[model samples]
Target chain A: MTTNHNRLTIHEAHKLLKSKELSSVELTKATLERIHNLEPKVHAFTTITDELALRQAQKADEFIAAGNSNPLTGIPVLVKDNMCTKGILTTCSSKMLENFVPPYDATVVERLNGRGAVIIGKSNMDEFAMGSSTENSALFTTHNPWELSRVPGGSSGGSAAAVAAGEAIYALGSDTGGSIRQPAGFCSVTGLKPTYGRVSRYGLVAFASSLDQIGPLTQDVTDCALVLNAIAGYDTRDSTSAPQPTPDYTQCLTADIKGLKIGVPKEYFVEGIQPEVAAAIRAAITRLEELGASIEWEVSLAHTPYALAVYYIIAPSEASANLARYDGVKYGFSYSDTKNMWQAMEKTREHGFGAEVKRRIMLGTYALSAGYYDAWYLKAQKVRTLIRREFDQAFTKYDALITPTSPTVPFKIGEKMDDPLQMYLSDVCTIPVNIAGLPAISIPAGFADGLPIGMQIIGKPFAEETILKIAYAFQQATDWHMRKPNI
Target chain B: MKLSREEVLHITRLARLGLTEAEVDRLSEQLSNILEHFEVLQQADTTDVPPTAQSIDLLNVLKGDEVAASLPQSQVLVNAPRREGDFFRVRAVLE
Candidate 1:
């Protein structure tokens, strides 16, 4: 049951499963063994579905024995806790829903399981997906598999960490702002924040309904494409889910980047970028240029500076409404006997949420409140429009935008815990994509002082295939994604 | 402008969180720091800009009203922390 240190990619895993070289049970057991060994140090899982996973694997084996084969038949994948999995504990890394078990599977989870992919467990995340670092997780902080002392960037921290630590072959992560990409960068894996509606968010615990997206975190772009093929489609359950045709993402993997236009925003390369991170990103762009991809400099996203402010306002505003459902009466944790219903709700929320989650809820409530609605919420939305317009203009001229996934490498835990603003700024480069509802992916570009750095590839709405193609091209040119953490 | 203790408590209440005086004191400072950082938004010339809620230009995805399967009430409340009959139970609202 030991994980093959040289585990095959999802594409290769499917090939082996079809050829009868590997059984789903064996793959699931290997991943479970890896989780048992590494999860203590990495804190990647909020709940490991060991028993349930074995049952699913057995079922998958039965299907294969019956000569039924699908794209993801017998593959094991992890899901972020934020995405509800029916009959499993779906705590969003918050005490508020510490005991809540969802009654229905998230759209992506249903799709994954429908394709016969075994759900390994629920991964940890920021409380309600509100923080940049998983350190804000009320349940447990997911540590970077590379360096245990550092954070796996969040709120998809556990998914990124688990995949990087080889605990799971691939995982589903929900990205609002940089949740998926930042953690993917820190963990040295590949993660895609598919176009906002590319993957359905029907049962995902909402952080910001408008900005949140569900995507795959995997070992490589090819695996990402495979997972995307399984998960991305129109779902009637999610009204916002796009009705556009889903492309075969793998088809673009072998496409040459001979004439692809890659835009490098001068605003992203400003003075504050960490030297090592900037150097690694610059090296990646240079490598792309060497591969015959034309690099365009001086492309401007003039609203870049306001993206953080706009996101903070808009996300929180949506979060305020989204999180209101956890009133301690419907499900999960509730306070002990209290004087009245109001007191019970107040006590439960007060005790349930961690600091960062409470801060955002407060900011959001205030922004959406009567007096400040026009001044803050409305104003932020207007700026959000401008930001989207800017991206639209840029995309008209360039195929995709490129930037450092994060401003700096993963900082020590607790270094910026007291400064929430500083932590929010960590997502400065990655937020605009979510704001614009475009597709974005983070791939391991290179290393900075032994820590991994990620290069972000952003594409137009519903252009997830293009982003994956670009990432696949970059990955083929480098060995970064293949480099595993010593842990 | 720095946030007052009263404003901090009001915000916490609006967020449905009960904060102790000590927590309020600490949060006031943290909230003030974050607000100060956002002060730059005040200078943004959004005078005539229209508010943008969605990224895509598409809007109003309407569907025909159709019957959908509803979860059994028992299963829906299966995970409720406290339940009574078919409804989720809570602390008594009235004295």
Candidate 2:
């Protein structure tokens, strides 16, 4: 088996599988071997499904032998721990649910399994998907594959890091607030946070129900599109899933960018953005312009500064309520016999939750409390409306908005763990898109001082095709996404 | 920004978790640090801005009040750490 450490692009692997050059079992085994060798150092996975993965890979090979080949057939993909997989210990990196084994698969997992995609493992994440850095993860922190000392941004850090390290060809991640994109930027991979409701969220342990979205993190934009096709669609099980027609995302990858209107949001280029990151973003815009896409400076969103505050309030507020179900009575880790129900519940939660998780829950509870509801939660929702409206007006004139995915390059782990406020600002660029519930993608823009940076493409709701098209064009023009970290 | 240990305890109780005194002291500092970041929003003139609740302009998605089959109670409680018959076993709430 070839164990060449260079990352395999999903498209290349698919072609090889089709041509009989490589079997699904071979690929799955290779990836598992890589995980065994690298995972201890990378800390990308919380639980690696070695037995289940090999079993699924054998099944995928049987399908291929029987002449049944699909886009994801025989491909191995990692899933964020938050997405439930039947009989798998799907801990969202929280001690609270450390022993929880879900009885059913998250909608995406079901879809991937049906398509014969081998489930590699569950990636680690910030507990309840709350922090900018994976340092908040309860199980263990996932180090950036490019630089072990730096963080793979979170809360989807594990997914991003795993893909970056070639542990899997592609992976699934959730974005509540830049959880997918920021980590992708940090790990130098392609990750998309589709328009809210583009994919079903059933069985995904809720973080912020309204803001949480599941999308793909892949080596390139094309694989991101393929994964999106496999996972996205309407599901009656998820009430918020849009009943819109799913597009063939691969068809949108045409190199023709003539007359495409790409809007560069000036607000994104404000001070505090590192000079190198700013230069890379500008170069991306220049590359797009050279490819026949018309670039225009636009003032689309002015309420971006409020996105973090509003997100902290609303996400936690919803989380506080949603997490109430895990009070020692449900399917999570529970306490032993105690004097009173209250004491048991208290002990279970206190021992289960990490410091960050507890802090967010408390903040959220306070925001939604009777006296504070009007001032915090309600007010935040109203501000979210304005943020959405700003994008709605912009999409009328522009095909997509482009910006830096993160303000700076990946920072060293534990650098900002003590300063909670500084950590929140790490997702500044990616949060507004989540606030607006729009389709957005992060593609490796360029490198800065040996570290990678990512550029974000935001599109109107249901305009996933347009966003993918822009990212595809940029990926073709630049080889940034192809640069594997020399770990 | 400053948060008293009392304030941290109050919030922790509201969140339905018990905190140790040491945890409370640490959280007071952490919460205060985070709230200081919230100061950025204060400069924004949001007086007339209506708070946006959801990103999509979605109306209530209602389904007919029809019976939908649920998982068997046995299956649901199969993983419960403590269970009694069809109910999840728990410490008694009151005398």
Candidate 3:
């Protein structure tokens, strides 16, 4: 048995488990033990479902014994706390839902369970997926596994960091903005944010319902494709889920990118980018060019600079309406001390939400307010159209767009904590994809200051296969995705 | 775009949040700063563009009105903060 079995990929574990050399129970135990030992240091998981994990592991072993095992059957996976898991304490890293346990699983969770994947636990995230750094979790800060003092770019920090640290073989993260890919870049893992509506959002706690997409973060692009294959499908439960056919994503993992055109948006490579990060992105572009892909420059996303502005307006505007359900009534925490329902709801929100959540709620409320709706909310939506149109225009010429996942490597934990604008800028490169409802993947491009830098490959609407093929080709030529953090 | 204390208070009330004086003061400054960032949207010439309410090319998707079993009352009520006899118990709203 491999001593560091926790570090093995899902594909590697799949082969071992199928051959009867490794049992799912042993794999689950190793993952659990790794999580247990590192919980104090990484603070990756919010809830560890040990009993459920073991039971699921036994079921996986049975499936393997029966020779009915799939590629993901025995794999141990962690999901961001925002994705509901039946009978598990699915807190979105907030005190508001700190005790909220849903009676159902998310559609993604149901799929994972059907595949017999051992769901080890729920990873930590920004409260309600509101912020960039997991420091906004309101419960605890999830430190970067690579450098414990630095942040793992969030709100999917816990999921990305856990995969990087080998606590989980693979994890699921929801990306409204850059929640999945940015953190993956910071941690040197592969994270995929599928096109909106490609995966069912039936049970995901609503952030920005339109932009919020559940995706996979894994050690390599292959695992991302496998996990995507399992989760990408339609359901009547989510009316917005696209009825588009989900191709076998794993089939697109070929290392051939011949005769494909790649785009590099000039607006993405502006000032304030760390020098090393820029150099690595340039080097990765060169490597891709050498591999037979043509690179096109100055593909101007004219509305790029306004993405952060548009996202803040739109995401929070939806969030305000979505979060109004948490007013101390149907479920979750309540401030019962108040005498009236109105006072009670107000007090519940006052005591329950953290600073960042409160700020966004306030921002959303202000934008969607009576007098300013046209100026703020309506304008942002039109600009959002323009943003998407830019991508639509670009995809006609290019198969995919490549950019730095984050402007800089992971910064010190408290560096961007006090400054919300600086924190919001962390998602600038990754935000436009969410706004446009496109699929994008962030793969390890290279290292800077001994930290990993992620390069994003953005695809057109429902073009996850193209980006995955390009990412796979890049991974074949480089060892960045294979570089594990020494946590 | 500068928000007054009264304006902040009104917005907070609209959002159903009871922020403290300290929080309100901090938010007054922070929300103003955030709104200033949003002022850039005015520069985008979206004259011929229609607003994108939904990003996907999705339209009026209607499901059959067939009666499906709703979640059991017990499971639905299980997570309620205050419950009484299968009903969520909230403070008096009519008054």
Give the number of the best model, judged by DockQ.
3
Off by over 4 Å in 1: none
| lDDT tens digits by residue: candidate 1, B18-79 | 87777788878877787678767777788788888877565888888999898899889898
User: How much is A428 displaced in model 2, in angstroms?
Assistant: 0.6
Writing each residue's lDDT as its tens digit, candidate 2 over A1-487 gives: 4685236777888778888899888888899999999988999999999999999989998898898988799888899999999999999999888888887889999999999999989999999898988898888999998999999999999999999989888999999999999999999999999999999999899999999999999999889999999999999899899988898999999978889998998888996799999999999999999999999966657777788898888888998988888788867878775768877888888888888888888888877887778767877787787778778888888999999999999999999987777888898899888888998999999998889899999998999999899888888888998889876
* Clashes by residue pair, model 3: none
What are the candidates' individual DockQ scores? 0.75, 0.67, 0.89
Error of 2 at A473 (Å): 0.7
Tell me how far the alpha carbon of residue A128 in candidate 1 is from the true structure, in angstroms, after superposition: 0.8
List the candidates ranked by DockQ, beginning with the highest.
3, 1, 2
For model 2, residues B18-56, the per-residue Cα lDDT tens digits are: 888888888888777776776565565556777666666
Could you give the CAPRI-style class of model 3? Answer: high
lDDT of 3 by residue, A1-487 (tens): 5457988998999999999989999999999998999999999999999999999999999999999999999889999999989999999999999998999999999999999999999999999998887999978999998899999989999999999999999999999999999999999999999999999999999989989999999999899999999999989999999999999999988899988999999898997898898889989998999999999977887889989999999999999999999988899889988688899999999999999999999999999999999999999999999998889999899999999999999999999888898899889999999999999999999988898899999998899999999999999998988788776
lDDT of 1: 0.87
Q: Point to the candidate with the largest TM-score.
A: 3
**Which one is best on lDDT?**
3
